[model samples]
Target chain A: MCELLGMSANVPTDICFSFTGLMQRGGNTGPHRDGWGITFYEGKGFRNFKDPNPSCDSKIAELVQNYPIKSCAVISHIRQANRGAVNLENTHPFTRELWGRYWTFAHNGQLCDYQDLVTGRHRPVGQTDSELSFCWLLKQMEDKYPQPPQDMASVFKFIAQCCDKLREKGVFNMLLSDGEYVMTYCTNHLYWITRRAPFGKASLIDEDVEINFQEETTPNDVVSVIATQPLTDNEEWHRMKPGEFGLFHCGELADGNADQLIDVPFAEKKVKCQAPTEPLE
Target chain B: MCELLGMSANVPTDICFSFTGLMQRGGNTGPHRDGWGITFYEGKGFRNFKDPNPSCDSKIAELVQNYPIKSCAVISHIRQANRGAVNLENTHPFTRELWGRYWTFAHNGQLCDYQDLVTGRHRPVGQTDSELSFCWLLKQMEDKYPQPPQDMASVFKFIAQCCDKLREKGVFNMLLSDGEYVMTYCTNHLYWITRRAPFGKASLIDEDVEINFQEETTPNDVVSVIATQPLTDNEEWHRMKPGEFGLFHCGELADGNADQLIDVPFAEKKVKCQAPTEPLE
Candidate 1:
């Protein structure tokens, strides 16, 4: 299993605060030390930084930590090798171009028999189950809708259905974005927190750092962060139940099913159905 | 017009030396001050760093110049905007994945009436003639060959034909790579130099930096550098002709027609055929 972190904000915002806490978990506080990657979406353009080295010690990671790149949407991951080798190719936060928009994805769980999923135009550059699943999901979308739907509700619902199917194989916690909206699907462990006006100070759980949101953000700003575990101890984080899917657009929940959290009772059964490829460390 | 830089090596080599010179041209010594980008290929995986800010003052560019990210192939560009606004979306050195391999491209010239070119599956995210041409070229390849060609000679010929067609619109000097080979098509100003064993000292034309290659390189290292203009004053760089197309694999010329140097008469005719959208600055 791996760790995932994501952010969406009404205004351009940096992830240095939450990223600092998450970087500690990459190798210092947690066991996800195989590799790490992050993608930042700025309008229709985006850039990604990845390292095969552990985030705690990677020089590139250090540069990212110091540099404040503001973006509306961001997705990051720290990996623990399971199905693929620990190399640059298998680093998380995979990206592909679809419908003239760049789509980015990162997965946290291993899927059994994922190769059965047929891929269309999009193919995986890395030999990882996460990348294969991403390619299949995009291909499915490309085949279903030749053009982007006028209403995004149908797209969100269709993606949720795909997530439910993948959950049947094993854990399928995922974070995906196409520079416009962020879609997160939870299977086991996922939490999110939204900060708006009247924000207060928050202290990180893994790092000895405190940030006052009110001082850094404008009153109209709305920012939301999603991660495998709550980065801060003071803030009230919402934990998603199994088989729950949510979509965020400009830091606000956009999907109609946002409140209707589905509690699909397939977590334990799916774990037993598929033989573990490698024992969870 | 823009400035292009590329590198191909038999072993994983860092382009910091050549990149330092190019960085100076991005804003300090040249007029290409709109944006800059670079891509580094590490085996089957690659990562890119791009900034809308001028490279001379860009913190990211400074970091890139200081950090030595070794790669077998690299493509970089400094933009002087002509058809598109100076923004991150229009930054050059765009990348897309095809046949499970990453393809990167950077153009050094403008196209006239290029919007008429019909793009198939691949589409340009930014409204730039350079990106539009790249997408069209890739889409053409994707349409002509579903899978990677077994024999690469035909593919090279097909790409050269595509370059000729693009040159019909206007200047189309470009640098492209698909992780395996670095292809350069010169429609105007493009120069290349290969350095092997018995290396000597080279001094940058833009910066006052000098590097003694003999002290840093091993005997088996074979590295080639390509740029819009000669980067080093002392090096014997080969200036490509208008319709000349060359392919480098593992730092050596792979295409048999590399020495043929076809000087197609389309250069003078094409300039008069298409009405220039923006005057040459």
Candidate 2:
């Protein structure tokens, strides 16, 4: 129902190239034209630019394309307006403060009964199912760990489990970040590509633009980008299978289960039991 | 230590004229060159533009001046960085969501021993006395009323009382909004001016800018602007008292006690009990 674009980098890197390709889809190359938003994290600090206007013609989007805002982690979204009206409040990516750190989220699917999810301390400022689920996930995490989790593995696993539960309702592709790490859950279409040493040229699929990574970075630089669709046609993009979850930190896969495609029977059974007669969009 | 600018309008009006004057003080005309931020509320939706650079020369600030982002309520700040480092995280105005509404705040004064205030569900993402006080105030409000208050008068009074308590720590001049109303509390220098049917030419104090409101606004339009100092030299601005708190809604003074200069004895006693040897900045 929407589109997502995310990035994690070992060094502060700008998403201007990938963002250009993505903006073309916001009413130009594709159908997602309601609104668009993007967040860039620089160390523990972050800022977001959101607009209810279509990104294709937005002055702010133009500024973002021209301005090189370097960040370690970035999340972006273009909405199709499935659950909320086209307004600034309902624009993705939604952000909240948890554990004294800013957490950003962007969803790319529709949930049939997401309103059933109970939100505790964190509440959605906008009337969007995406924001509702984000709040619910954060509330669940806070409930489980009153403070920051002792181990990062447990936190990643818990987030994956929550994604599995959310996938049972409907499609649940998402991108989440807390400045340091990026967690992506794929219930449908999602792809990622990492650029490291020995990088080469890549051409955008949506636009007639090309960039040589060799000229853009040093050999030590590492950058990873995740998107609903691959932005570059020539690059080798890794497509994630449905129900797969991956965690990236400092531009590299950090989760032990990053490549694993384990099927959770509990989630499958719940989905089978609550399957709607009407097909999901 | 900083400067604040706020606007409350009956109609969705652009504050570009006033903002141009204020941005001049962010480096060109004054010493508040650390950072600047501005928030504009359109109905229940709002967006902010912030930069950890001098507003006088910031490209984003230039865009803000050129583009007209109309809103009914706005809060802005230019920081001199008294209690925190100069970074994006420490930029104002800070924002948080409570009771499904976005609340924005910007402070122009320092508070000693402000970290003692207990924060509840809300937490500050940035390490600043301004954000800490904001979170504490919101936490107090939530503790008293879990849901939206039935009577706005009580909420306004409670907020004023909280401001009174915070003023005991030191100078606590602040501007706050919950999308619907703009609340201004002055512990030192703060000024306001209202423009309605009888509009005339006004000249900026910090910049050579002049505008005839007769050509820009309608006769029925009611708008109010609040700032740490008078933005325009030609306009008659009302200077508030040290202990005064005023609430503006729909571009007009809505709080019954907006003009009352009441001194809470409890706050006075606390200030007397913890009076430091050095005068507050």
Candidate 3:
């Protein structure tokens, strides 16, 4: 139905090269041409952009193609209409603020009987289930704790509970962030790759372009990227099990081995985007 | 154009409440209704979702409304058409591979003469400039070095140079990551907020919802959120200047003083997503 792309790192890095390659999939090579948007984080600040045009033709998208916005954390999305019409209000990558901090979110799966989840306390601006889920999440957070968590461990435990509850309903693969850390969960298909020192050429699967990070980064650099699918054919992208979740902060897993991982088939390692609508398989 | 939402933190916390406010803009409150997507950095990997449907009404969006996906780093987006036809291939958030890592990206503005940016080596799957820009960035990375950078400083510098160069052409605001670090550039509207122990009640600009993070989070948490616009009306938001570019690492600006701020009014701060297609007034 659509595609997702994200990154978390220990050092600052630009994602222009990789982003450009993924953009090709929106009506250029693939079919996710409903709309698109991106977010870049800076020290307590950020840069963001969006366009309802296909990544293959949006002039604004072209400008982004030519620019190299860098950050420690990044998230992006492209849409392929399934349940709604293509428009500005229906694009992906929703955001909100909590505990004096801003939180970003994106999803790639569909659910049954989601209307039951919508609450008046947090209403949906648009009509998409993705945004509705975002609202529902906020309500739960407020309901669970009137204030922020006491520590990282406690917060993670609370979030873990939330995710488990959501997964039980349907495919709940998704991403969440507070700019300092990233939390990702997969119910159907998800993949990831980490980049550290000694970077090398990486060819884009959607485009015939490649980049050599070694020449452009220092030894202190540690970057990681994630997506609904494998962005490159040659790279090793790990797929999440049917029900799995993980957290990323500063280029590493923040859960600190708290979340369990399942032994997945190596063949499943091949990454690809997910469909918000349930697959007919 | 699309919308972007992000968050960062020093301690783990759920983004449900904040995400709820932002999701309201997905289709119910705002105009960006093309499609919706989001990413939650869960430990080492990311949980992402993309819907070809309006996030406002999508069932998955509804689940997100109620689900509390916790994360330290998060990114989200909502789309409005400008390039590719309405479909799944032309959504905003796009992912790829580079330097042996998954690179995720999303865009908002438009560019001119971007066709020249697309290379046969990195052909685009979408029809938007956003994807082409991603390819071009990858091309530069590949041509500049044979591998990933060994020095973090050198990589950041080069990326900044590239971003600055693109800013000269038009609005190139972008967000990207390889999972270890995040890179961001601003040519238009962008803002961020940091949240710590003293959380407060924040309301969404688009929807009739409010949350008191102080009631939900503890003092040890340091969370940050970035966006194209401030989701709430009461809080303060710092906007990016024209042609100003920078990065975010560890939920903060990569550069201690990346931009030399000048006295400007809010009127000048508004940079529409179509920077390349439309000149700044």
Candidate 4:
């Protein structure tokens, strides 16, 4: 088991403050002390760091606490080690090249017998079922589309079905990005928040940390963050249904289909958007 | 502070067991409670889920405890909000576009006077300094390369400088990735573990979860996970030092530097990682 943190925004930003508070729980306020890691997206590149130590005590963690490596998107994790060893190779926010683009992913669940499903050019680096499951998901996607999909909704639907079947083994809460859009699925635990023109003050439940967005952001900034648990103490959070999924692009809801957010019939929840050329009041 | 969870492997994997244990800490075993999210990678596509609720109590979290989504590199977060409202927009593990690639980020620290340092194409979406810093990092990189780095090491070095400057802001433990490589920096709190051919059983420190990778993975498999804390109870975790950065690619160190592990120069260790075309020996 581990802790998860991520960010998706219209602009480049840092997770320093939030991460600082979160780090306290990694070992000090909490007990995920098996290992820790973080990934920051700097354009086409990545600023990733990890260690087989607790965030609370790791000297590197202190550096992270003090640094402000900014990026538009970020994915981070702290482990409690359930399916893998405490080593640098087993750390998360795994990366792979597909369709000529880099894709990043993170999960917060376990699979029972996922190893049997892996089959393809891609393979697992470590021995965690989490990694095996990643291989299978990618294999299936590659099978469905040799290149990137033009219609994100269709692409997400296909993966949703795949995830639906994977649920048979165990939980699967995950985050994914192709440096363009972030697609998320909630088979179990997942939560999100969207910050826009009207910003506010927020506090951490795990640590005594708080910040006000109005003081740090512009009126045009729009950002959305997702994680395995709520990070703030004073705001209201919407809980994703057990079987739910969503997409974010440029800090807005890319997948406007309610079917992905609830158990409503796919047909009932489907909400297609008109092409940009055809949009008008 | 919040928690972060990540997994990088040669094969696809689902972080069910690890996430489950982490979820308990979201609002039960731990204090993170602003929002939650996760992303799964499927070849060139992605599946993501986000909710503005605590992972421990949200029914969606229950589903993730049961479902099984997988990916090679996965990032998840449980927030204790500090910048934006406890809504869907302020969660961590944000994603954005850069040079036609998808980037993801997650942070665990704070930054002062960061607003002045970060100013460019990448901007904050939410109110957290983490998102602002992410934007600043991306802006700097995008400006620096215009194109990707000539090599992984150069890119790592560039990012390392960025991390260094940001570290001066306060705390900046972070993770960044571009699907090809996962790079991380330890400003305050970060840690990771690598699971390889010789896998072993690991137990959760915060929840009742356990798994034996040796029983499920092939010897060729190499999986790495990074987080803010150790994910297992029975394991030796390495501490990442301050002012340290590492890269994980294909479940191995890309920098090819083994000395990255002993990076803790001083200041209580924060996080910890390596590669090379030119063989060291």
| Rank order (by lDDT, best first) | 2, 1, 4, 3
For each candidate, the alpha-carbon lDDT, in order, equals 0.83, 0.84, 0.65, 0.68
lDDT of 1 by residue, A170-254 (tens): 9999999988778999999999999999989999999899999988888978888999999999989999889988887778766
Error of 3 at A178 (Å): 0.7
Listed for every candidate in order, the interface RMSD values in angstroms are: 12.5, 13.1, 18.6, 16.0
Give the candidate number with the greatest lDDT. 2
Instruction: Output the worst ten-in-a-row residue range by lDDT, candidate 1 chain A.
Output: A272-281
TM-score of each: 0.91, 0.91, 0.48, 0.48
List model 2 lDDT by residue over A91-134, tens digit each.
Answer: 99998888888899999999988889999878898888899999
Separate DockQ for every predicted complex:
0.31, 0.27, 0.02, 0.02
lDDT (10s digit) by residue, model 2, range B220-256? 7788999999999988999999878888776876643
RMSD over all Cα atoms, model 4: 18.9
lDDT of 2 at B122: 79
> What's the distance in Å from true for residue B271, model 4?
28
Best model per DockQ: 1
Cα miss at B50, model 4 (Å)?
29
- Count of steric clashes across candidates, in order: 0, 0, 262, 272
Worst 10 residues of 4 chain B by lDDT: B272-281
Tell me how far the alpha carbon of residue A22 in candidate 1 is from the true structure, in angstroms, after superposition. 0.7
Off by over 4 Å in 1: A256-281, B256-281
In model 1, pairs of residues that clash are none
